[model samples]
Target: MRIKTLLVALAALVVSSFAVAADYYVDITNRTGYTIYYMYVSPGKSKSWEEDVLGNDVLMNGDTQRVTLTGYTNPYFDIRLVDEDEDSYTFWNVDVSTQDIVVTLDHLD
Candidate 1:
């Protein structure tokens, strides 16, 4: 009986850990006619932007894409966009506790 109880506790712990690492989807929208060259998401500031580009995906205007990230927490989702250096934008602080997040990219031109 004791062993069964211990096993149950262990199983619960494992399940909870996996739940904490839940998956989230973000809608990337490019309002600008120009295509966004790159899109990236990371835990914190990264010097090498290429390394942090999630799945090497680029979002075009009026397009929506979904990417998955592991170990995402609440209150802040780090995301950024770059268009030929001259046009770059980063949303440092995002609240992800909600169901869905809509990111709209405006035209720099």
Candidate 2:
């Protein structure tokens, strides 16, 4: 019976760990002096960008948007933003779990 209890407890711990993986959100503030038409975020190890987080919406300059990144365990991400002039700005290997992300002209790649 003790062995069975220990196994159950271990299983519960593993399940809880997975449940808390990347189950958080962060705010993305736009300070680049342009309208952001598209935004993409992918895992740091990924080779391509994920779907647009804006989804037909626009983030004008001086605006902030909350981006929820749930179900992903990876803390590092690659963020890309497209402006009204079709200019692309990329920020690589950003830790999106600890704090909000603020993008400005200085972030241009």
Candidate 3:
């Protein structure tokens, strides 16, 4: 009976660990001539909020960087890339529910 209890507890612990959410990584590259001021990522179908602003150091030409998010549960995400000239390039309404926990971006401006 003790052995069975131990096995059950071990199984519970393993299942609990899997229940925890995962973190995701996003890589951004600056292909544009201008420097990017900031970027944002937010939850499903909601108006983009400033709180989600990812203050990446001014991304210059051919520069690349990565951002990590933990316990993100949004079905839809929006990315706004802002330039020094106040020009914003918006990648709107992306569904990431099925995407891997790790997200990598290349030259996504």
Candidate 2 error regions (>4 Å)? 1-20
- Cα deviation of 24, candidate 3, in Å: 1.3
What would the per-residue lDDT of candidate 1 be over residues 1-109, giving only the tens digit for each residue?
Answer: 9999999999999988873555655665666555677777665444544344534566666776665655655535667766544476666655444533344444232
How many collisions between residues are there in candidate 2? 0
Candidate 2 per-residue lDDT, tens place, 2-102, comes to: 99999999999998877456566768899999999999988889999999999999999999999888888878888899999888888888887776789
Best by lDDT: 2
Q: Candidate 1: RMSD over Cα atoms?
A: 5.1
Give TM-scores for every candidate, taking all chains together and pairing residue i with residue i: 0.57, 0.78, 0.59
Off by over 4 Å in 3: 1-20, 52-56, 95-109
Better of 1 and 3 by TM-score: 3
Model 2 TM-score (2 dp): 0.78
Task: Kindly report which residue pairs in candidate 1 clash with one another.
Answer: none
Residue 105 CA displacement from its true place in model 2, Å: 1.1
- In candidate 3, what are the lDDT values of residues 1-109, reduced to their tens digit? 9999999999999987775566665566677777777777765567645453555457676787665656865445666777777777666665554442222243344
Ten-residue stretch with the least lDDT total in model 1: 100-109
Candidate 3's clash total is 0
